[model samples]
Target: MSENVLHLENVTMQFGGVVAVNDVSMDVNEGEIVALIGPNGAGKTTVFNVITGVYAPTNGRVSLRGRVIAEDHPRGKMRKMYAAGHLGEYPRSVNNTPDRITRLNMARTFQNIRLFKSMTVFDNVLVAKHMHLKANFFSTALHLNAREERRMREETMELLRIVGLENECDEIATSLPYGQQRRLEIARALSTNPSMLLLDEPAAGMNPQETEDLSAFIREIKDRFGLTVLLIEHDMNLVMDISDRIYVLNFGALIAEGTPAEIQSNPDVITAYLGVAEE
Candidate 1:
């Protein structure tokens, strides 16, 4: 089996001539933690969108587990042009929905907390679990699959325990403290049993102590679940500490890709984050 779990090849996304991501290519290897970091609008999220099937690239290909999941003008009108130029390489069919992508054992959490505000914390995780149910809707509607429901409930409780949210399971999702709410989001994502996880700014609104706890929590899950992670975050310290490799983007372009130590010493990377003075 290939060591790479995900690969983006020359992926370019243009929104009506406004290029959000330009000819960017990167990879996430099996069982490694990788990070994509850059300025506020450096197309980090755009790349995430393309990879996750939220949008198809104007020109490029995206692969997961060596399978061409999306290619040839994905969600837009760029298909024939792309295939005409690349032929066999771009013949991949478009139109894998976000839900379909999740079933491929890839899951993600948004930068903003997107928990079910009205649902109890437990119910939120249960939602993802129900997706894997084998019972048909007719069986579910008639309450004829009580065993499935019971097993799902047991698994949901186990998942909450693993994420340290067992105590908050009964609370309304939005009622929890900010940090706990974030934990709940992670729990919800994990309910799908994804092999690879994508986290968007998991520490975005956290304080130092919360961030510290979150960093540890992320590592624990990665190790315990035997999962690979690709994250988009701005917390340099956290990124440097946990990531095995880093990819830096600036204005929709990839400027650098390396380890934490290498990225820190690269002059171009320094200039991208902090400007160079006129000499």
Candidate 2:
């Protein structure tokens, strides 16, 4: 079996004449925290989109566990789905849908907080479990079976405990402190039982203390859940502290890849940020 859980081979994405990601190839090995860091508009998020099936690459292949997951679409399905008004129908191909990717054991949190303001913290996480629950939509809609509902509640509680938010499970999602909201987003993602967790700027807008706490929480969740985390972060302290390996991007291309220590010493990385000549 391949050690890598995710792989991108010679991937490229173009918007008009601008190449957002250019022939970038990378991999995330199982049980590792890989950080993608770069200056603004350096294609870090573009790479994330390609991995999560948000955008199809124009040039290359994306694989999961050695299986080809995405290829260039000869005919875009979104156009047809929109024209036919069947955009919510079942996905015809793996590459064309985000749910298909989530079902394949990949889950992601957005850069922005997308929690349901009116829903309780527990309910937010519970909603994510709908993807894994065996009960059909009709069963849920009609409340036909007590067994399914009971099982769903139990599983939801379990996920809440995993994220250390069990105590505040009944609080409205928006009422929680900023740091806890970040953790809730992660718990919500975990309800799907994903093998890989993609966190987009988990530490964004956090204060120093909050950031430190979040750093510890991330490490705890990775060990307890046995997750391979791929994070895009601008917090140098957090990235250098937690990531097992680091990949740097600049202007939509991979400019450096190395361990945190190695990256800190790389002349190009330093130059990219400092714009100073190396001695």
Tens-digit lDDT track of model 2 for 163-248 = 78999999999999988999999999988889899999999999999999999998998998899999999999999999999999
lDDT values, one for every candidate: 0.88, 0.84
Root-mean-square deviation per candidate:
2.6, 6.4
lDDT for 131 in candidate 1 is 75
> Candidate 2: where are CA atoms >4 Å away?
73-94, 276-279
Best by TM-score: 1
Which window of ten consecutive residues has the lowest lDDT sum in model 1?
A: 79-88
TM-score of each: 0.94, 0.89
**Native-to-model Cα distance after best TM-score fit, residue 168 in candidate 2, in Å:** 2.0
Candidate 1 Cα misplacement greater than 4 A, ranges: 74-89
lDDT of 1 by residue, 85-167 (tens): 23245555565888999999999999989999899999999999977999999999999999999999999999999998899
